[model samples]
Target: MRCVANTGRMSRGECSSIRAASDVGTAVELGAVVSQWVGRVVPHEGYMLAAVDPVTGVGCFLAREHGYSQAAARRLIVGDRSDGDHPYPFDRRARQSRVGVFNTDAPGLRRNEAMRDVMLDQGVGSELRIALAHAGTMWGGLVLLRPRGARPFSADESVQAQRLARDIVAAMRRYAAAAPPEPSGLALPPGVLVIGTGGGAIAAERVVAATPSAREWLDELGTRPADALTTSDPPVESIVWILTQTVRTTDKPAMTRVPTKRGWIVLNAQPLTGGTDVAVTVQPAVGTDLLPAMAFWHGLTPKERAVVEQVLEGLAAKQIARRLEMSPHTLNDHFKSIYRKLGVSAREELIARLLR
Candidate 1:
């Protein structure tokens, strides 16, 4: 895709911050950089950089604001069920066969089908979107939203945002290739792997233990665990092969973001310059841990996790009850819910399962 150069907004370091960031760091850096440009000196609602998987229409939220949860954001922005038709920005310029900025308030979007699906229906009164396109396909984009009745993105602001989007696209590709988010290699196994041509198992890395089938997911795209992923399964890889493929058609470093129940998972890949291997780093797009991920898969709510933390702390039932300000019966109910959700019958088993 074409990423035009611009000036006077993002600092050089901020533009290059993704180079040093982890997968999540890429998202954070994108958010911070764009905010610096848009916010000027003040913070706004927030922004998002999502990597789209064209085939499935599901990518992960690389970076977002505190007000927007990754899961919900994924559902709204890149989810197939949400806006499978009538994409923004790209569609606005589709007739001209170009990729550019799309503003919800512009005449270009007056009757746009995707606008309702993307912004109007989602409580976003106004938005500015820029698409990263290559080979007539959209790989990823930046979406800035405003609350209903808030001022819509001005024409000047939209132009600036679009220009910034283009400039960052090329820089992002370079940073991803030069220094991917992977650890030294899969020998260290950091929930990511690299595959060879023809989709064969070139390397298998250690994913989170409970997420046993992450290896197979790495084996081939669109494949899931052999067993049905119950509530306990980590959200399937929100793998993004779109932009990586777009930017590195023949040779380049590329990355993508996949959504999970707890957060986004970034899949960064680069062809090893000297070897046939393409290093792919699989990691969270945000700071997260096993407990929260596991809890999410098992359908454990925050309150349940709270109870679990107290239990893990060796708090007696009486103490736990007092702390939560609930009666003993209510505490027992939570215990029962936790046990059922976690598939355990006793406290010892619960602790063992959790620890394991």
Candidate 2:
């Protein structure tokens, strides 16, 4: 219920609209709502909204308007040659604050080859970036762009955008809390699902020796064989593909967690020895793998999480109370709060939500 700082131009109705949008069902619906809000509030010609992987800072889902060419978008998404040199890289900004503005007229910007090319090609002059973070993990981002000669975004506007981003994060957490339990029919047990990848022209990129489990996990993430070229701008690549590509090119291990209808699935990649190939392992995330993010998404306090962990381990209420050195009454209160925040009525439901 935090209010936007007094940005004189915002109407009471506009604020209410954003608050309502926060309760929308999915990230895509929320993005569409925010796009309309930004059009009226900050006045931008182009926008990009992404659900990003916090650990790897890679996009898991994206929607954009008036976007860069596929070439440029790929560079930006993969950090090929575009990101590290930018004045306000997403990774660096994620560590500092939720909102930032970048102007092409800034001294060093024009000197940056990647930044200069994108701005020149897109005919944009000002960029406002919002990193939507909650409980220390970034879940998404919003970027707004204005054409050349438009006034640069001001400090006050950045403040306004920060407030909006905060609301967006809050909504995302609630959505996560209410997400349906991971499907059990898939019965994909907790084990390594192997996938192999080769890099080159999009046509040449391929998935080799992918198992049925691997394919199921890939399908859950909406991934296709690298050759299934879609006609969309910034052609889609699953987080698995992205991690494999990252590991192949960087010669290092790469890992990221992606949200799926089933739950969070962990993708881990490593350069396979003796070739230009990478191996990616996909599996259901364990409690440790998902704990911090679940805590963040459900707004659970540390004590509440401790109680949940014990409950997941099949502890009795009294045993948990004794272990945590809390009275039975206090333990019950914590359970109540955890259940409410997580939108679960009992320990079994809480375990299902968290354990996948």
Candidate 3:
């Protein structure tokens, strides 16, 4: 229905359809509702719906059908190739399209009538388009189309569609907010570290008093053996000695990486943070386990191992590809192999293994 001229009114039937279709919950349910709504509102040969992530700017196709539900029309917007020879109208640039209500007969529609032609190519005729927005953000949208001889969306129908869009936005936001946070991947035993300037030793002392392990460590710190070389010249060495000596009496592995002016040192164990800040932040090249090592090995092909060695040396994929005279796709294929072999899911895991 033509949303711009509808004056935002809805008949009982239209209202019922809108309400029934906009009650989105899970992604699957949302896909079903959107498909049904498109079938009801658009007269096109096919239809589809898409939801865009607000934070990540990634667009995901929600639903599509070819002959009966504006499916061709939807594919034109999303560049899904199976919809025969129909040309895609929308591209990545569509994200920047201005948001507002527009008449089906407006000049903007005429200028951008590739959307209309795609429907016509599929034997559908007219169309109604509406932009969905929430808190000024364009998060998702619906495009309704009708066959050439069919009636366009009435002004009343368009208004109802806009209201439905608002409801969908609210539902999506609530669903996203209530979702649980994903895990961070790192696992640690129950313990807390007190970190501060040297002046805050009292706070550290209090932490030690409250935690039995910390109390024992601090008590041991005060009774260093005469053979122990006490030196403040290398702050990192001092910290490493303290950590190692305290944890040596216990079964737990001691903290192994201590920051030093030159870089960092591997204490009783090997360095996990690597020797560089970038590696430390991005992959922490230390404390990794077997899965990561396997994933790394699996991600590579024999020939690509040379490229991967450069990657390990901190070279960008583009640079490595260029140096190896290989396409980025080839490099990517190697990485996928590496990921499969390593039994881990990502490059970060491989990097973590190297660091660890």
Candidate 4:
């Protein structure tokens, strides 16, 4: 018995050691991934990695080797824009720099340096900014800095940084999928299950088409349309609400709402899944009201309305294409027309104007 107990203890120690080593390995892998783009920029003396909360318009520093601390980064990126009650201009210039599009040659970096002093009391060296945009919002960003006397980012470096920015965004998406849903007030994790007669088929087809992985689980279900509808965990409420309210529809496609702990869970059910398949989209019922803007935005042409609605809901061009059965290039054209008519340079401005 003693011998067996000793052996078990040894096995447990080895298991713990292996787990620790695995964690260290993962950290190294993440570092290597970032390192791949270092020289592609301006000799990369240091870098800042940050994640943005789309809903709150907040940026959180995930990692940084630059002089700025997390608090400093957040304050600088999401600082007050009011300028003492005089309304700030709505142009792209008004928006503070978060991560992408930083240039050593431009005035933006000079402004950032001034703000850095007020917020953090530190000055950043020459740097290149790159942002990770997903689901229509800038979710993460990277800032690669060079010490004094280092070369500014060249055109080639900027292009390489953009490519690296894309990888960072992809990594964040994977992280979000793997991370467990945080605690919520609801009994179940918020999710929408679509159900309807012909509606269910249409909705299911749309969902499966939009999310390829959904097909794997949906394929195992019965073929009967009604059988599929019957299998929905939650009964349908309002079709218009589910379609328009939950999943913000664009002329091209519909997008899933940003997941939240306290929000509505929408599900759609219809006989056919050919059209829009979003059965449910979760939205906050209490504090924020997006319906007024959504109504106005949806009043535009199906295509125009779709683009506007997705913008209001905070989805990016890539996500819109997936939901709408169109290419990103096509969606960009639609956005150009939408912006022209609305007289807005960016989606954020359009949303802010409509919501007001």
Candidate 5:
């Protein structure tokens, strides 16, 4: 029950958090902080702070202005970006330190009809966006939208937003790091699922590969594809909670995160294609440094990964060769290549790098 007092001149859109659990308390707090910060800075309709992972091409909004609808907010959080060329102002143009402003009536935008259409379709009169970037990576950005009939943002307001962009990026960065690495050994289909209005499974499908993190999430829900529409579980209850809150009109509850001993499992539910059932996506919050991520980065082949995994187990060359069904000489070749590509000197360094 943290209180978000007014921070600046604009003193509107302040609301109390109804989420009781602390599983996502830090992120919720970050949202409250950013939302309040935006409110204080300008007298706009709403603002959203988004965290984007350029490596994964996944983006999330930690805080969204209160006036947005749950359906719209959910789409923004977990929907497809290929809908059209929208007003994603914080793009490569702002990859450095530039702040972006998108206004429907701006004369400069008369030539870019696509941009104008996006703004009109969104029913927004103006917007402010800033991309959070570091070391050539675009982590994410912030966007403030003013609805139709509202006045366009003044230059000072844009400057004020620019000043806060870096701090907001840092805030999202800390929020992402707070989730411990995914620490479970359960398996399930990819990150997608379909839930009924009552929070029971309707039909589930895979959008990502199954991993221990996904399995543990299903275990938490006490659910599976077979249980679709059959019964409700604790996890289903939580999903139902979010659904109910979303329907409350005032609460902009778009997503929920479950805290675990090792890390965080996030659940994103949206209305399915037919609008009768909700689709839920499950994912781990922190696991970017794991084997697959490292292997891809280090350009390791399947054989290299197998050999490295064996080496990390303290197996000697003879045993590793026998187990891999390769001769001792052949095993030595892989070790040499692995060492060279990974910039490691010996098996010890290889294991150290992998474990890290």
Candidate 6:
């Protein structure tokens, strides 16, 4: 990854502005507040703030966009997914530099297979990508886009974005610790969503078919009108397409847990017709799917989560300490912190909260 020298600093007023935005609370409110602030500082035509999955590096869970058409956003996300296959993927680049620039005319664009074509097609000249990570865990990402003929994002502006990232991501982490969404009332069984490509000079993609229950999940997710399915109108459709691409490339099932307003739903995709098409199944997320996210929601540090895992296995404190290569005193301290953060007083309480 290339490193940018710190050529400038943000003013105290600008720093305070970001702090205020972080304090606004909730993912939606944070996006609205921070997007406006970023536009003022960076001069972008479109903005996206998303809460991404730390493990998968996918941002379909919770996202808010402004000033971008549905079609454009869908294409951009689909293109970004293919970028994941690059030798130097977005997550690694983001880890190296919290803020980075993407230019359509750069020589590196050719190395990026999918993003280049999408950027060219969309007439996007430049993009500023900010990784919303805290203490080595990625909470989400922010993207600012400029159209063709616009000036490329400058090094100084990138420095400003880097400065703003810490506060913004810290707020997003707090938002992640909030309660999970409620359960969807509909008790329908798991359903299928089929995806395939049409014959064209450029293989246009479409939703080939979907089960009734799958359609219910789409409606529950608030996807665009039925006409939009062929073109992949909503963000959810972008996620489905991304999973399809993954299944085709790896010849293995691809899966993700999507958090909707009602609750989390598991989406699993498998290749069909020798990878010519992909079938995605939608169902309620189970305990395994919810456990990792549960630790995140309670703001458990990685080490603390390790301790919780041992507890779930019914290990004694001394046994867990020995297994984790920590002293009993240190283990006790971790327990105290976990209990305080989770608002639990005992091991049984902790288990109940986690299982629930």
Best by TM-score: 2
TM-score of 3: 0.35
Superposition TM-score, candidate 2 onto the true structure:
0.75
Q: Give the TM-score of candidate 1.
A: 0.42
- TM-score for candidate 4, please give it: 0.36
True-structure lDDT of candidate 1: 0.48
Tens-digit lDDT string for candidate 1 (1-356): 11223435667775555334423334445556555444542224556665444322234334556334433444343343234354464321332122233345444354345434555555665655667554344445666666666666666666566545544444434323233221122222345444343432211111122334346444333323344234432333334333233223447765544433232344656765774555566654432223443443345667888888888778899999999899999989999998876657888876654443
lDDT of 6 by residue, 1-356 (tens): 11223334556886677665555434556676677666556667766776655655544444455434656665665555556553323342345336778888852234265656767677777878887776666666787777778778888787778767776766565554443422334488787877777542112457777776777776554433564544533223655665676676678887765555445666788877655777888777655565566566457778898998888788888899999999989998999998887667888877654444
TM-score-better candidate, 1 vs 6: 6
lDDT per residue for candidate 4 within 30-149, as digits (tens), equals: 333454334423356566554443332222114455445544543443342313221221111223322433333433334444454543254444556665564344555566665444
lDDT of 2 by residue, 1-356 (tens): 11123336667787666767756554556666677776666767777777655556655555566645444655455443324454444441355346777667752124255656667677877778887775566777788877778778888788878867766665555555544433222467533433342344432245555555654666566544443332222233455555665665567887666555556666677876777666677786666666655565566788988998898788999999999999999999999998787667988887776666
C-alpha lDDT of candidate 2 relative to the true structure: 0.62
Q: After superposition, how far is residue 206 of candidate 5 from its true place, in Å?
A: 13
In order of TM-score, best first, we have 2, 6, 5, 1, 4, 3
Residue 214 error, candidate 2, Å: 5.2
Better of 5 and 6 by TM-score: 6
Model 3, position 111: C-alpha lDDT score: 19
The list of candidate 1 runs beyond 4 A from truth reads 1-26, 41-44, 51-61, 66-68, 77-122, 133-139, 180-184, 188-210, 213-237, 240-356
TM-score for each predicted model, relative to the true structure: 0.42, 0.75, 0.35, 0.36, 0.48, 0.72
What's the best-to-worst order under lDDT?
6, 2, 5, 1, 4, 3
Q: Which lDDT tens digits does candidate 5 get at residues 50-97?
A: 554334323333445443443444434222223434444333334554
Scored by lDDT, the top model is 6
Error of 1 at 19 (Å): 9.7
Clashing pairs in 6: 182-262
